[model samples]
Target chain A: MATILQFDFPYPGPWGEEGARALKDLAESIAAEPGLVWKVWTENEAEGIAGGIYCFADEPSALAYRDMHSARLASFGVTDIRAKVFDVNEGLSAITNFKIA
Target chain B: MATILQFDFPYPGPWGEEGARALKDLAESIAAEPGLVWKVWTENEAEGIAGGIYCFADEPSALAYRDMHSARLASFGVTDIRAKVFDVNEGLSAITNFKIA
Candidate 1:
């Protein structure tokens, strides 16, 4: 079963088109992360926040990514990062049409 | 272009095994909703919260589900429901290994 890791932090600029251009490299780097199945990059311009919902192969991978990503974000001057890891209810999720491959 | 809707509310009971049994019907009903691609049920027992991350075919579907689900949760005595709709950066997300089909 995959684990879900969600995180968000305050981000003030470069949303929409500019954001896509600015974060391309970062996105690629994240894709290469071990045990990362996929990541949905999320941002709320109105709320001034940016983050992602990630699916990892297991809890260890999810936690490892969270720690590494948190440090990376901290290095970039983000002070308030909110992150959580959840055990996915695969049976329920499948009933709601969720799929993992 | 799918939309992402995430919501969480204060819930104190029935996590883990109990949660799976309790939420099965709800999951099926959610799956039958229009334009719903899938849902990832999420819960954080330590935080005493429960919710889901859903992918809908469009913004309207996402918003509609949020409204309906919020009301349902409110009726169940959940007073504080936090919900957000996020526009996906699909191009960037692709680089991060995200796919929606």
Candidate 2:
């Protein structure tokens, strides 16, 4: 079953196009992570928060990536990172038009 | 551009297969909603919470669905729903292996 990984942290400024330019390299690296299927970059400028929603092949990969990413963010001076790893309800999700596999 | 809609509320679920059985009808109805690209049903049994992460074709559609779903959930005696609508960074997201098209 696929796993869902969500993480967010407080961020200041540089959203939209500029934000995309700045994060392009990091985004490319995330693409290469083991067991990663996809990721949707999320940002809230007014609230000053940023995050990504990710899908992984399994829980193990999600957990591994979560730990790695959390550490990476901390190294970048982000101290308030929040992360969650969830088991996807694949059967029910499929009925709602999301296909895993 | 796609919009991400995330909503979750407290629920004591009979998770796993039984949960699927219980939500099948609701899932089907959700699949038919306008502008819905996909929805991944999420739950945290240990925390007694349940919700979903959804992709809608646009922000208007997402907001509309959010209002409708919130009302429906309330009708089911579920309050305390937390919902968020986010704009997707499509260019950045694609680099992370997710294509919003």
Candidate 3:
């Protein structure tokens, strides 16, 4: 089953171009992992949070990515991170039938 | 079963305080809808996108929110909106057991 991992963290304060650069580097690194299928990065300035939805090959891989991501976020001094892992139910909706590019 | 709605879109260009203010207004309005349980707004400048993950009471309510949201995004001249709806399977993962505030 495809597993979905979602998480978000606040930027402590306003994140300028430097922060954007850091996130780009981190995302590229994480996406390079073998088990990750794809990821859709998301952001909302009004809410002051940033995160992504990742689709992984399996539960173990998803959990592994979670650990790695958590460590990386911590290294960047990003605290108060929240995340969840979900098993994608193909039968749930027509939207689930198609993958997000 | 709880339904999950995830989507994102580019901000066209740099979005400053005014853009954030517009989003805040939209979010507040959406959250006030009768069927929405909760939503997590996410943003990332490096990727140049913003969006959210929402939980709704059912499919109808989820779809309704999508239409309203899409229209609002259009009003703001935001294009390339992408959205997907999922039925939350409570048995998926331990993380699914807890909701993001």
Top lDDT prediction, candidate number: 2
Which scores greater on DockQ, model 2 or model 3? Answer: 2
Model 3: iRMSD? 16.5
Candidate ordering by TM-score (highest first): 1, 2, 3
What ranking emerges by DockQ with the best candidate at the front?
A: 1, 2, 3
Clashing pairs in 2: none
Which pairs of residues collide in model 3?
A42-B43, A43-B42, A43-B43, A43-B44, A44-B42, A44-B43
Task: Give the better candidate number (1 or 3) by DockQ.
Answer: 1
- Model 1, first chain, TM-score of 0.95
- Weakest 10 consecutive residues, lDDT, candidate 1 chain A? A92-101
What docking tier does model 3 reach? incorrect
Model 2 misplaced regions, further than 4 Å: none
- Report lDDT (Cα) of residue B81, candidate 3: 92
Model 3: how far residue B41 lies from native, Å? 18
Model-by-model lDDT, in order? 0.85, 0.86, 0.61
